[model samples]
Target: MRGVTELLRPVWRTLPWPSLGAGSAAGLLLAGMARLYPENFDPWLALNTLRTAALAFALGLAFLLDDPARHTTATVPVPRFVRQSLRLALVAPIAALWWTATVLLIPAELRPPVGATTLEAGAACALALAGSAAWIRRSQEPEPGVSVAAGLLTVAVLAALLLPDDWELLVAVGDPGWDAAHGRWGVLLGAAVGGWLISTREPART
Candidate 1:
């Protein structure tokens, strides 16, 4: 136990606690402001704001590996997966707590279905981290969140504008597409996990 604790201390110390805190604060503020406007708030409106906040906060999560030492660390005797596993270990609980708090922040009467909405949040979070992982693998940029954020926003805008009605990912509650949209969310989450795993692999030898 002591051996494991010693191994993780360096990784934990380097984790971006500030960005995570900012993301949680931003999500909470959005949820709280929506609660203040209960008169105009509906389930659909609540879902929209909550989903947007989750995605916005995930932008911060994308910075998890944004270290000036990533390239140097990559060459260390420790395995890449070991280092990243430690990073995830440290953040997973905080992320779960943040999600729970985000859900609770919604007014009870207007809250979206927790299970379905959580699937969306999970997918969004995975996509953000996967994007950053891909960036680090390909570009080796110590800090890649800036481009990841821009790319994420671009993809979101295009998804909203270009996707046809039948295949839309974000649909209003009670719409026929709601269940189908979440079905796609499941697929998205799977793809993102796969991407992250692949991206985190050590680079090939020339």
Candidate 2:
């Protein structure tokens, strides 16, 4: 347990930039694309991008927390689950900070509906954190062939969820317009999963 904690410390320090970069890039691209197609784009779509970026950031933090590098000294005294919980606890505030910054960076007109956006951002953060915890606790690194299979399965599931029927289903739940507002949920989800996988698994010792 001490070892795991020690291993994760360095990851926590260094992994923030890459995750922030990915989230920012994803957010900016979505915003840019919306601007390009003003006639077709709904301004509210920016909110989705912001929410997605927040989730990506949260997931990235989770990966950093789980990195084997941060666990070195961790074995001395701490129980593994306790350490893991401590790391997970950090995700909420960091995600909140990221969301605050993101909201500040957006143009007033392009920002999400005020109070609702905050709630959505918080929800995304929670989802990302929960998902990462689940993955870390239950999943293992797959063999090459299995990895490919898993990737394919993820794609299939995403497609099924984002396709026309899926859109209709979401609409049935509430707001059919939301399905058409932003189509980047799949990309955000993929980023969260990929970032978690890449960050948490052991890398060659540096």
Model number with the top lDDT: 1
Tens-place lDDT per residue, model 2, 1-206, is 56665646653564445654565556555555545655554444665555555544444443433344433533456554555455555455665565666666565666655555554444444445445544554444221222332443364357547777544312211365654423444445456555544544433447
- The clash numbers for all candidates, in the given order, read 0, 21
Q: Top TM-score: which candidate number?
A: 1
* Candidate 1 residue 179 C-alpha distance from true site, Å: 1.0
Residue-wise C-alpha lDDT for candidate 1, range 160-201, written one tens digit per residue: 899998779998878888999999989999999999999888
The residue pairs in collision within model 1 are none
Q: Which ten residues in a row have the lowest lDDT in candidate 1?
A: 1-10
Model 1 spans > 4 angstroms off: 1-4
Q: What's model 2's lDDT at 60?
A: 45
RMSD of each: 1.7, 8.6
Where's the lowest-lDDT run of ten residues in candidate 2? 141-150
